[model samples]
Target: MATDHQQCPVAVIGAGVMGTAIATTVLGSGLPVVLLDVGQAELDRAERTIEIQLRHARMMDALPSGRAPGRLVTTTSSSALAGARAVVEAVVEHEATKVGVLTDVAGIVDADTPLISNTSGIPIDTLADPLPRPQQLIGTHFMNPAYLIDLVEVIRGRRTDEATVTAVTELLAALNRRAVVVRDSPGFVTSRLLHPMLNDAARLVDEDVATAEDVDRLMVGCLGHRTGPLRTADLIGLDNLVDSLAALYERTGEQRYRPCEQLLAKVHDGHLGQKSGRGFYDYREALS
Candidate 1:
């Protein structure tokens, strides 16, 4: 039997860009999903956002070999999460915030219902500690714009069971995501490798090595990066990046993990990214 045929509905909390993308991708694979948010307003906004993205995806499908997917639903109640087999928490990155949400949501589901985090830098070992079934807790870090990215790092915490990891990988395969199993580390391999590199790029800008645009262009054109760190930061949202930086710094105690001064200033100034419409570049008018 097909995995989708036997698969239970997926519950995605947070309904942010990444959450909705994951939900959308899963729904495309014929799996139903319930996107839950803490507030009704947020739930409504996310539902609309998913609809817009669905339309764009359908347009892409209409191109020569089209295959647009059907839509999914959203909810604001924990009660709606009753029958979900897997819950992906894409909530705020604060440790306390995550633990609180997961702890609460974990109580309302079966012990077999896997609890996954959409977190990127936070350690799975730390986040899984307070959940109901720690063995069933894992990290499923989807790249930004999850609908567009192919990589989904499936991280196994100290208490996470092999079976839990296996089930998540199987589900990702169904959604057409490339899932990579990595050990539960402070920052994990990807974040450890990436933050240092992005930090170096930020240092270049802080030290006046090149303008932000020039540094970004050089990296993409010369270094063969699809998207340079500076621009990537803009898209990732500086606040989110800063949070990751703090987590990595505290975990590794590495000076390189310390976010650049200029970067910190931008974040403090509220020039977060495309969401705020300004960061390393000016976009006050365009965004307004």
Candidate 2:
């Protein structure tokens, strides 16, 4: 039998931006979370990030009042995942890295506990291939600032069972989020459609067609997009965006998904957007 969601903590295997955001979302929903990372520094940073985000949410009245936030446990040990009601893998985008984490997590959590992957583009089936129970593996592509995003793209792997999908959708519902189930595909729906636009946006900048600010201005002001492609790339982290683009390109053999030279150069310089204070645009001042 599946464990009670209310009584057991959710295991978040990563302390990066998405992991931290997901943990914050789960905690805000009043469910305890075990946040695991390989680095103590990263775990410490994640804890701080969660605290600040939660505090800000409370201030903006984004989180419900009069309910204490759920407890958060940060650790570097996979053993801490024992008895988790569910496991969310938000590790790095590399196939090997994700597969390794999921394989380890499978051994710790209950056999029936849902395993959700927050991969931006990787096919859920590919990640599930090495797992003991592929049916329990599904993808929950939580958008950036997961606490604020109301919709999540749910990907059903070839072997993913209906029960796993139902349980995951129900969990998301409890967080006040809607899940749009989509068939498994390289990059799935969001990244397949999104990365091409981001690539073209970067190419425009590379070719001197427009400045990053003006490009974003055109998209936001005239195109009715809330955020422009370049800005979105920055928020996603240029490094991570490049990795996703490369994966999409490799998986689909599509030229449109190729990472632009400018983006690659930016990452090489470590101007990793909001995280590094620079990318398509400088964010040091804003971040400071």
Candidate 3:
């Protein structure tokens, strides 16, 4: 028999780029989703974003056919999360903000409901610290463009039990995503290794070593990489990259993790990559 909570919608907290993408992925799997944010404007934008992404996915033959997409409910009320089957937190990468959101989510959802954090690099155990049911809290680091990414990094906290891990991994499988389970650590596997290289790529552009185009072309042409590091940074958003790099540097005290000056400058200028219409490359025409 399915429990009442099991039949309820998955709750996604935050309505930013990653949040909307996650909601779209869940909806693509035919699961209703409640997308919550503190502001109505953000939620409205998220709704539009999800609609467009869903259409694109369908056109690309990326979504499952013959099944109507799941219903999406946008809300500003935290109480709406009470009976969520699972809660995914996709707020800003700052530790304090995530802790505050997870702490509140922990109280609203059922005791058995899994608390999934879509944190890029922050440690899962650190985010679980504020929650009463720490064992239910885990990290599901969905890459940028979550709906299209086929692999997800699953981080298990120190107290995360076997059942929690199983539940999350199974959920990923249902969404047509492979889960690569990794031990809890700041930056985990992907971010820790990827960010340093991205930062160096930015350094090359900043020092006039090569034009962004030349650098990317060399990487793609010579290394056979699908996308160059700088272009990947643009897709990931310079602001997000800076935040993740800062978090890693603060947590590990590693010099390599320090965000390069070029990234900081780009973020300060509000040139946030593809979403902002400009970054290393001009996306205004593409976005328009």
Between the candidate structures 1 and 2, which one is better when assessed by TM-score? 2
Candidate 1 residue lDDT tens string, 1-288: 223323568889887667777777776656778889878887787777777666665566521133445347777788887768688998877888889988998888777677899887899989888876899899988876676667788898989998788878887876778898999887787778887787788789889989889988998999898888888888777788788888889888988888888779888899887767798877678655
Which of the two, 1 or 2, has more lDDT?
2
Question: What local distance difference test score does each model get?
Answer: 0.79, 0.89, 0.91
TM-score on alpha carbons, each prediction: 0.90, 0.97, 0.97
**For residues 1-288, could you state the per-residue lDDT of candidate 3 as single tens digits?**
334765789899999989999999999989899999999999999999999999988887878777789999999999999888889999999999999999998887777888999998999889888889999999998987888878999999999989889988888887888999999999999999999988999999999999999889999999986788888999988999999999999999999999999999999999989989999999999878
RMSD of each: 3.0, 1.3, 1.4
Q: List the residue pairs that clash in candidate 1.
A: 61-66
Distance from true location, Cα of 182 in model 1, Å: 0.6
Least well predicted 10-residue stretch by lDDT in candidate 1: 62-71
lDDT of 2: 0.89
Cα error, residue 153 of model 1, in Å, equals 0.9
Off by over 4 Å in 2: none
Question: Which candidate, 1 or 3, would have the higher TM-score against the true structure?
Answer: 3
Instruction: Give stretches of model 3 more than 4 Å off.
Output: 1-3
